[model samples]
Target: MKSKERAIVSLLCATTICVSWRGFRSCSPPQDQRPCACERCLSKDDPCFMKRFNKSVEPFLSANYNLSEDDFNWWKRLQHEKGNFRTFRATVARLFLVIPLSPDVLEPSPDRCRTCAVVGNSVNLRRSHYGPLIDFHDIIIRMNAGVIKGFEADVGTRTTHRVMYPESSVDLDNTTHLVLAPFKILDLEWLTKALTTGFKGRSYAPVMVLNPAFIRYVHHTWLENKGTYPSTGFLALILALHMCDEVSVFGYGADSDGNWSHYWEKIRNKKFKTGGHPGNTEYKLIQELDQQQKLKFYTGF
Candidate 1:
């Protein structure tokens, strides 16, 4: 080959080598191992806060009722320590951890906010025996799209804490209820609009809980603990189970008929559902808790 031709061929080979290396780096997937920054989990409550929380949570369970050491340890280990979780997919150099939150958050509300109830609109409430039982809770936390009117009167009306996404169907007024929304980037503009000009010092208090933290926490927990993050309904139920003393869960799950429908849907609509909040496995767990008498279900299912 001529000297000029040899130089050109060598140049082409070098270019090909660089291009292939770039492609290889780009195609490589991320690794699962990650630091416990909990940047997405929210509570970096520090060891002191954790120490205080532990002290209060442990003894409270033993004094209030019977909790075997194993059960208590299981609850503690599962909820507090990320060690109990399993890892999910790694994308963009991120590792998601999923841990099953302990049922221990049930021990008489560490802060004891008088009364709190977490409510969901399961078709079970169509039977309607929970109104009075619900009223007993001083603070009631109801979630997105849950019907306040047209269902049982007392079971829902006295709501103190109403949790809704920015796109939630429920309206917010000064006298209506406190709004707790988990934050979202997609919802950022609406959230900004709500705070700056829309909800501006509106009558109702607006509380924001970032969704990424919960999602990251739940995702991590799900990855580590097993199964989907226990449905939003079950999580809400679990939140209530943890926060309240005399708790009542009204309007959740389907009757034996497998007719999983809500009472407040458009008339004659059989296709109604709880949106994307949770699935059937969670619905069953709710029933299990009810049967154990850990919580009172007003659904009559």
Candidate 2:
């Protein structure tokens, strides 16, 4: 780990400080005696619940946004040394000028339950037939290139948000939100260029960039500083916890045969791993969340 990262981990370990959840004003009210949708509002019986949701971190970047020096340095060190703060700021400025930016905040409601389904690209979804169940949610969030063309019965056709990087991006209709999980400065540059040049013909769709501070928050708090950074799928899962009253996870982890592959594609590499992300740790966290009834988890066969 880098010196800065080590310091961050040490600080978290030393203080055990939990940041407040910032964007949402209210959390969902419980039905009967059930737990609320927002984990922060859960009963204090589980001490660790307090540390899970950090409201201080903004989820999406808006127009005329500026990152503090500390956040800038921490974000730049996430993947590669793409450029300096000046270059990053300039790129963001130019990008915001061309593409329309929106504050995509989903506030909790007392009368309504905003359910969300976070669908990953795991091959386990192949024959799950979770389409109707997934589409039943108020919001459906898909990640990367987890295609839904012919696999609609298994992956669902409705997608409120699609979380992706430049490489894993797919063309979408205007109804879906293109949530970019930027790993490096180059990914931001790519988004700017892609939107400006009409890359993948996605100029009409709504766009939102994930806040780097939120990324850091997830790294330090949610994953406990595990792996290099949290995977895009895991980030989307956390985002769902903040945006919806009820959350359901689908298409994550290896299949019944312990094979890792995309649902739309055949398994070419039997020895596939989650690359730089801590796959096991993340899956374990997901299971724990399920156990706590924070979110409903479906493990497809």
Off by over 4 Å in 2: 1-46
Point to the candidate with the largest TM-score: 2
Instruction: Give the poorly placed runs of model 1, Cα more than 4 Å off.
Output: 1-114, 152-154, 175-183, 199-202, 216-231, 266-278, 291-293
Per-residue accuracy of model 2 over 1-301 as CA lDDT, tens digit each = 6999999998886665333232122232345443443443334455676678865567887776777778889988877666888888887888788667666656664445678999999988888999999999988999888889999999888998999998888888888888999878889888888877887665546688998988888888999898999999999999888777788999999776666679888788888888889888889999999998878999898
What TM value does model 1 have? 0.53
Clash total of candidate 1: 15
C-alpha lDDT score of every prediction, in listed order:
0.47, 0.82
Supply every candidate's count of residue pairs whose N, Cα or C atoms clash at under 3 angstroms: 15, 3
How far residue 280's Cα lies from its native spot in candidate 1, in Å, is 1.7
Evaluate model 1: give its lDDT. Answer: 0.47
- Measured against the true structure, the TM-scores of the candidates, in listed sequence, are 0.53, 0.83
lDDT of 1 at 96: 13
